[model samples]
Target: MNQHDFLIALLVFLVAAVVAVPLARRLGLGAVLGYLIAGAAIGPFALRLVTNVESILHFSEFGVVMMMFVIGLELEPRKLKNLKKSIFGYGSTQLAACALVLGVLAALLGAPWQVALVAGLGLALSSTAIAFATLAERNLMSTPAGAASFGILLFQDIAAIPMIALLPLLAADAVGAVPHGPPAWQTAGKAVAVMALLVVVGRYLVRPVLRFIARTDMREMFTAFALLLVVGIALMMDAVGVSMALGTFVAGVLLADSEYRHALEADIEPFKGLLLGLFFMAVGMSIDFGVLAQAPGQVLGLVAGFVVVKTLILALLARRFGIARGQWLLFGLLISQGGEFAFVVFGVAAHAGLLPPHMEALLVLVVALSMVATPLLLLVFDRLIAPRLHALSRRKDDAIPPQHNPVLIAGFGRFGQIVGRLLYSQGITATILDHDPDQIEFLKGFGFKVFYGDATRVDLLEAAGAGTAKILVVAIEGMEDSLALIDRVRARFPHLKIYARARHVSHVYQLKDRGVEIFEREMFEGSLMMGRRVLEGLGIDPADARSVALRFRRHNIQAIDRFYPHYRDQTKLVSLARQARDELEEMFRQDREQRQKQEDAEWS
Candidate 1:
């Protein structure tokens, strides 16, 4: 197609989407659903205003690829490692179970073993985008059910690779001819090798390359490299006749460890988003609205079938995993539909002779309808399902408010714990805010008093009695986040006194400027402790050693006051601060010696 045609197609999709998404959101539905509806409405079946949608779909296919790449950027190797149990344990089970159930159902419905198997797998996987976004929007991402849902989604991602690998194998073409699009073994082997290469490169090569690019300080270069990595990998896979989604996901996993992961992710994010919207629109355009009109019962029947079948499987699975009964139902209801892969598998299988054309068209409608239904469907869980679960949970286990304490602790990590324990012996009742459902979940065993929430958020802080608390002790770690929280608290609860921990002098200044009454540099105590012990061991009297320690603290405080302004700028870094401290230490030595000599002369 020419540039003009491309621009016109884009305008149609965008204009439709811009209008549709707001309407969906305003109706308490998701924008994804809106985009799908927009696509369908502007499509051949409706206005027939847009043509060449198949080409647009092909072009927009890269959106899925980009989404996978961005998904890869967000994941960390360490986090992946921690989720190994969930990935293998819960993930493996859910995939196998769902696939088996769906496969059996397909076979019963008269599909061949291979087609049925693929269909089952396609039906088993849930929408990660919908599940996560809805969870986050409703503020349930931090909840147990939310965490469990996340674990399952992580498994689905890993599962997609194998499914993609299996697609060609399931084809009926002869091994010798361009017959089934290459032999099954050849296809599988290439997929394995490509994956292996990504692991090796991502682990060994990506970091240094990123560092090299970073040194050049060219954003366009980095973006170019990022896009190039995705496109290159995708093309490589495509050349080998593998799925591009598989290639892009591999690219992500490989670049997962690059310290430049976030920057690369940020750079690629806009492209991914645009591409994904286009892809969804293409999916929308692919829908056979005419087929639905001809065989409304068949199309809707399959959708209902898929939802009922998948929902039952998911609920049973959730229950088996020991999620509370109510959440189990919610989980089941949330995931029971054909996923994004259904579009690919449906198109490919129909073309590959696995499914009859009529059946394929029916399934395509089912998949499209399912995608559109996702956002509204999740509202069932978020609104009706979740509240009922919470109500049940409340009835099963109730809570009582803790007595007030002067000091309120938000996190009981190493930082908050020390303050809480110290205050505990003094008969203090410290109210702590900790929103990690995992930690709060186990708090009962430890007999620790903590609540779940982001302290920077007003409701959470209010729950912790920020208004009534005499002192707010911020023992939270991390420089940037802590500063942000300090600023937030200072703005909302101005009268509260804050004592915050700083990992360095800069952190000290950051907290101090926020009006924190006490900001202890994290490393200062170690230095002070060392100096005190040395003085005591050097035969200094206990009382005089204490005096010396106080005198040293006074000098250190004075030095900080003098140098902090410049230190705030990178012009006075750690080395500069050390140099300034050395000069102050030398002056102290001279002052001590002069005072001793004057005392001796007076005695004489």
Candidate 2:
């Protein structure tokens, strides 16, 4: 409570985090486990140095908020659209199925229905932060299995909204207790109003506010304004008793159109990392080691049950849903754990008379142990399941049209296919530069020109297209290499107005620094183009359609001017971008509506 204790707690947390995280990661585990181990080590069970206190949880709560904010930043409309089937279908089904199966088992074991439901939901989901970070670190996110795992995680995150609402109702004392804090109806009403406000502001207001902020050209003010938006919205959402996580998600989704979305993500990232670490540590602290020591068998059994139950369910579900066997196996194994929200739900249940404290403590241990062991189970999937699937997947490729373009495309195994095929139709000559020399030469005898070269190298760039008198479309693979190519090409070939691909907003900044004009990222093509087409498809004339798109384009282009510079800073970017998106979207909406109204009146 005092400054001395606060500083000590801070030091202990920072020191524990710094030490434990890298150690776990080096051992092929994730930071979540490190934080848990760190917390446990420093608790009375080990070091007995930092006394657990109420302030610790409050301090760690900020981490959860920051993490959620970043998560919100990443939940851009375009990315979410790409993940629609996985998030809504696989993710939804996995959570529900896991919860139902676990709930039934718990109920059969003499647990009350309410406690069983709450406990089951706790064990049904995996940690998104851990799974994603670990997979990305291993460069496996692009794999089908990896993507499937991600979809389920993203869906679980979105599902947090309904879970929050459901928690109170699941509490047996829900009808009696809620009258103390604003009436339940009032809380529900405020939540609805806040969400409605987010939609309206996101739809009609965000863009113009950003445009106005742009006109001012005050960079510091803009960043401040962005953070203000995140905190303000987060605060308002918290005030209405909605989880700040869900609020930030909604805000992030709404601001997907804003130029500052990526900037906001980068800015908010570090704080999210720290605070989220704290949140995980707090979750770890909640685990009753005493209960575990007393009933190690029961604790370990609960964890094993989740491993077996969730894996079987997810495996069968993935198979029935037509996921590749390897992918199905991966999906099953990866999701065989509980999530952080288990602690939140359990605490609420205990408070609401839904769960006995002794039982609640046991559930906490189960969730903690499951989370701690998650990364290891992933190793099982990778070592045992994935390779088998890869081997089996060979036969299925028989039906796949063979790669026709001789240009050995490295990344295009997906994105590069279009460019390669269009060139094929044009009868243009090319050779592919890929890291896999074997794959390259294997296709070479098949009447395709394939070669092995690191595309980022100047020699490789030249070999691909630097001086052979043809265009170089620098879709040369990863963001780093792609941006490196942009820089290299700019200096080498002043004549080439480079069309560099931007993977994220950070990549956009790097390209922009090289004065790249035709920069394309996934979102630009995926949603922006789709929106323009939808308008035209609705019988809107080409002129109006182009004008509408042009207006958004110009606004976004200008907004990018601000977003690019503030890429690494989080606090200010969130507030400013949120405001800018609010302002700009409204101005554009009003202008478009006014024109439409005039056209309607004329027709009348």
Candidate 3:
């Protein structure tokens, strides 16, 4: 197609997406499927609105790269450190098992050993984008199943580096030619060096540059810098024969601890979303129905067999790992689809003459079909299967009535444990529900009764005696879970008084909005203690500092209520905050003056 034709095609794609995505979302099918269906409709087989699919596909692959970068941004270094074991253990096992199983099946179906291995490795990868999106949408990203799924995805991304390097070797053997590239050790050395350089640059050079740009207060320029960083790292990785996605992901990990992490995510999000939508559409466009029509049974059978096998494997793993039934089912269905990386792997193989055109097309078709089917599968699980399972679980739970404990603590973290310990010292028995199995085990060793379940779930709350508990102490680490649990408690058992913890000003606002009159900011008291120490260091009397802290605390509490109403309106909130600050300073100054005058009078 000419330049004008390309422009026309772009307009058509944008228009179709704009119309189809919202309609699809309204109909309960996600935007991914919407883009896919739209692509298919406008593809050569149907409306023939845009015929040059290859060029678009090639350009849109960067969307997947951008996606990896964004995913890395969400994974902070601390969270990754906590998840190291799962990432290596479950992730490595999933890859090895899936490859072995699928490789053997491919060999049995007449593929050569090399080809079978490539196919197995390629198809073993699950779609990270779809799986994470599904989990995040349902607010399950903190659950065990979600963590496991994320770990496996991270491993797949890491595994892609070696797989890319291995592809040419597979191709070389297939075509009986010497591999015309750097030796493996040299490539490994280069990759390590490049990664180290990226880390250094990100930590030392990039941050300062970002800070300088931030100081200028130019939002657009800072956003440009973010893009430049991602694209520059991508180019460097590509230059060294590494995957661009891997490069950007590594860059993202390095930047995860930066103060600008959230800002970078916000800036890159729109580009990521649009490009990813285009990438999905390109996949849909590449699905040649003509090829499928030639071997309908073979195509359909392969897709079904792959999904069933992967789902069964993931289900068994999740079950053995003690994932909850509802979460495991959702996890299995969400991750059974082949990933976008498969497109890269298959394209590399096909270019190397390792796969025949027909086989490559068939595999691509299977991957796309699996991706398209994921949302539908999730909808089925959510609507049809989940309700019956919940009912059964609830009935079974009802058989064991928890011992009567007047106080129920939803979390057993540092915050909740302190409350539990204090109550224990007073001889008040408290029931604790914590989802962290490790924490529950530790607390059990300490002779505390802690149940392993999500506190936000109503059934678990019922099992914990929320119906009879006199007070609920919500010290859950996550603000969302705390708020959700509070909402449920207020609706179901209004009589139970709630003492909640707020992580920040925004969280405090949310709690106040929810009628939680007795919530404490998690850091407020500690900050007040620090303020007292600072006052003492400045040579103020200990008693005076203590009095000042008390007064400040009371006034801050009152200010919270006044400021919360305008929280959503930035202008009004800023104005109110300034007014509150000035008023507090004036009051404190007046009190100091009164104390000085009284001291002078007493001396006279």
Candidate 4:
């Protein structure tokens, strides 16, 4: 396509996504499906807005690589080691079972054994991006179901490495080598060598380089280096006949221990999010409406059969693994769809002469359709099935006692207690609410007025006399719960002064945006105290150290206020954070120099 056409296509995609994603999310379908629908809406078969999808697909594949890299960053060595049981136990068994069953089913449908094997393996993989994104969006990523899903997805990522190498072998000629390709053993050796090289270089070379860039305090430079690292590793792997996605993943794991992990993530996340969206759009664009129209029954049969088989297999595996019924069902539905890797595998197989053009197109359509159906499936299960399951299992609870106090304290945990105690010492009665049943009982034993209920609930808030309360202290550990409670207070008890405890700068920004003017991060004061102690340990006067810490704290709070408006733009936020850090350091240095001069003058 020409430059003009490319720009037009880009505009079309951005516009479609901008319009469709919010609407889809508002309607309860996730962003992945929204992007897909958007792509289909503007595709050649529909509006014919952008016909040349092939080029965009190739370009957008980097998003998948970036995603794998981000996933790797999350999987620090400690975390990966922790997942050993899930990865080997449930993960391995799940893949093997799904592949075996799907392969058998494909063979029964008249495909040759080898082709059936390929199909089975391709279909066995699930959409990691979509699954994790959905789980995280709904605050389930830390739950049993999310953990299980993540473990399975990590295994699938690892499995993709071998599968990529194996595909060329599956399509190898009768002479035991691919056409113009090296022998299977040689290919395998080269892939292993490439992986080793990536690890060694990443461990030794990359960290120092990243540290050097980070020390420069230029966020853009660091981001560029981060991108270069991921893309460069991917290209190297691709040159050596390994999957680029696998290469980026390996690089991510290697950099997991680097000090710049968070910085790299901050820099790379926006790109990853955008590119992933583009990738989904590309998937939607690649869907063949004509083929679907020609064999609607066949296509629908394939889609339905794929979902049923995968879901049943996953459910059985979850059962064997002793997963809870609710979680197992959610897991089954989330992963039943075909993944992005299927497109690459299908392409590889077709090029290797294993799959016919028609079969490749058919498989592609199946994968796309299945992906499109996943979010809808999740919505149905979450909205319809999950509620009934919970209703059946939920037990009746004792009524919460009415509490009428001038001050209402939510989340009487570590932070909340200090606030509560301060109020108690002054004889200011504050009704404390806590969700932890055991903790509530323990606190009540200590003669503290703590109640058992979620503070975010309007009824519970009302029970706590929120309408009469003058100040609301939200010190919840869970960020979402804390934000929910803040929202409720703002809407219902706007007269109450809300003093929130934020977990981090992001939380501070959220609270700031919501008109919670009086909030402090839980760790900021503690960290400043530690810094003050360190200064004292370094021979600085204790009083001076305390002053320095207080000044730094004030400056930081001011910086957060200044930067809060641009929090949504990660790059700008990172830059602002760096600038604030630099400014604080410079201020401290100036203070120390001035203090030294004054001491010298006094001695003279």
- Winner of 1 and 2 under lDDT: 1
Candidate 2: where is the Cα deviation over 4 Å? 53-55, 78-82, 139-151, 154-187, 203-223, 320-322, 383-604
Of the candidates numbered 2 and 3, which has the greater TM-score value?
A: 3
Give the poorly placed runs of model 1, Cα more than 4 Å off.
Answer: 107-118, 128-181, 203-209, 320-326, 396-423, 428-604
Worst 10 residues of 2 by lDDT: 396-405
Clash count of each predicted structure:
3, 38, 0, 0
- 246-343: candidate 3 lDDT, tens digit per residue: 78887788888889999999999899888878877877787788877999898989999999888888887887655877667666887899998888
**508-552: candidate 4 lDDT, tens digit per residue:** 888888998898878878888998999999999998998898898
C-alpha TM-score for every candidate: 0.66, 0.63, 0.71, 0.71
lDDT of 1 by residue, 381-470 (tens): 677777877765552211326436678886667767778878887888888876456566776577667776666676567656787888
What lDDT would candidate 2 get against the real structure? 0.71
Cα-based lDDT for every prediction: 0.74, 0.71, 0.85, 0.85
Better of 2 and 4 by lDDT: 4
- When 1 and 4 are scored with lDDT, the better candidate is 4
TM-score of predicted model 4?
0.71
Clashing pairs in 4: none
Badly placed stretches (over 4 Å) of model 3 are: 1-7, 319-322, 395-604
